[model samples]
Target: MPTVSMLDHLVLTVADLQATIRFYEDILGMRAVSFEPADGSTRWALSFGAQKINLHPADGPFDPKAALPAPGSADLCFLSDRDLDEWRQHLQAHEIRIEEGPVRRTGATGPILSLYLRDPDGNLIEVSNALHS
Candidate 1:
C-alpha cells in the first residue's frame, strides 16, 4: 500500500471564483500563486504558508453544487503561537463572521483559543493559538 504523507491542496468548487479568491487573499492573507486553464474553464491556486488551495469555477457545466459541511463538520485548523485576541480582532475588522470559540482551553491536546468561520464555499476554517506546554 502506498503511504500518504500530507495534504498538498484542497480543491473547492465556488460560486464565484474571484470573490472566493478575494476572501482567501484579502481576508485570509493567502497569496495567489498560479492559474491554470482547464478545458473551457480556469483554476486558481492560492498559497497559505505551506498549503495550497485550488479554487475552481462553479459555473462549469459539469460542476457539482457545494455541499454544506455537516454540523461539527470537517474543519481546517491553522496553528500559531500568536495572541488569539489579535486574530479575533483581525477577522472582526474585516467583517468576517466568526462562528464560535475564541473560547479558551477547550481541548485536551493543549490549551488553545480558536475562532471559526466559513469560507465563501461553506468550508469551515479554524484559526487557533496553543497556550499550554
Candidate 2:
C-alpha cells in the first residue's frame, strides 16, 4: 500500500475569515494570504514555514470540500520557534487566555513543551517546542 509521505497543508472551515486570519496572523504570527482562484472568490490561507492552513468559509460552495466542515472542530498542535516561556508571555501580551498546559506532551519526534489557547472560533490551538534531552 502506498502511503502519503508528509503533510503539505490542511483546510480549516472558519466562522469568520477575517477573525481567523487575525488570530493566526496577529497572534500566532502566521502570514495571511488572499488569492484569486479564477472563480472570482478570494480565498484565504494562513501560512508558516512550509505548511499552510487553507480557510474555507463556514457556508462554503467550495469545490471538493469536506463532508461536514465546521468551525471550532479542530484541535491543532503547532510547533513554535519560540520557547514555551516566550510563547506564554507572547500569548499573555496579546491578552489571550491560556486554557491549559505548559505540560509535557509527546510530539511526532520526541517530547515537547506546550501551551494551550483558543482561537477566535474556539479551535483548540497548541503551541509547542521540542524538549531537549
Candidate 3:
C-alpha cells in the first residue's frame, strides 16, 4: 500500500478574492501570486512555506474543483516559528480578534500552543507553535 506524503496546495472558494488575499498577506505574511493557466487566464494563489492555496471565485465556471465549494467553510491550522505571545501581539496589533487560546493542544509532532481567529470569510483559522518536550 502507498501513503500520501503532504499537501501541496488546496483551493479556497471565496466570496471576495481580494479580501481573502489581504487577510492572508497582512495578517499571516503569505504572498499572493498570479499564474497563467493553460487556458491563458490569470489565476491567483497564496503561497507560504511548502504549500499554496489557490483561490476560486464563489460564482463558478472553475473546473475540477471541490464538489461543494463555499466560503467561510474551512477550518485551517498553520504552524508558526514565532511563539504564541508574539502571535498574540501581532494579531492584536492588526486588530484581529482571537476567538480563543494559547490553549495547549496536540500537534502532529507534539504538544502545541494555539491561538484561534477567524479570517475575513469567517473561516476558522488556528495559528500554533509546537511545544518541545
Best by TM-score: 3
lDDT of 1 at 36: 51
Please provide, for model 2 over 18-55, each residue's C-alpha lDDT reduced to its tens digit, 9 standing for 90 to 100.
Answer: 88998998898999988888789889989899999999
Query: In model 3, how large is the Cα lDDT of residue 18?
Result: 91
TM per prediction: 0.73, 0.93, 0.94
User: Of models 2 and 3, which has the larger lDDT?
Assistant: 3
Name the candidate, 2 or 3, with the larger TM-score value.
3
lDDT string for model 3 (110-133, tens) is 898899999988999999998888
* Local lDDT at 113 for model 3: 89
Scored against the true structure, residue 56 in model 1 reaches a CA lDDT of 59
Deviating ranges (above 4 Å) for candidate 3: none
The stretch of ten residues in a row with the least summed lDDT in candidate 2 is 59-68
Measured on C-alpha atoms, candidate 3 has an lDDT of: 0.92
Error of 3 at 54 (Å): 0.6
Arranged by lDDT with the best first, the candidates are 3, 2, 1
lDDT of 1 by residue, 86-125 (tens): 7778888998889997777555466777888888767788
Ranking by TM-score: 3, 2, 1
Model 1's TM-score against the true structure: 0.73
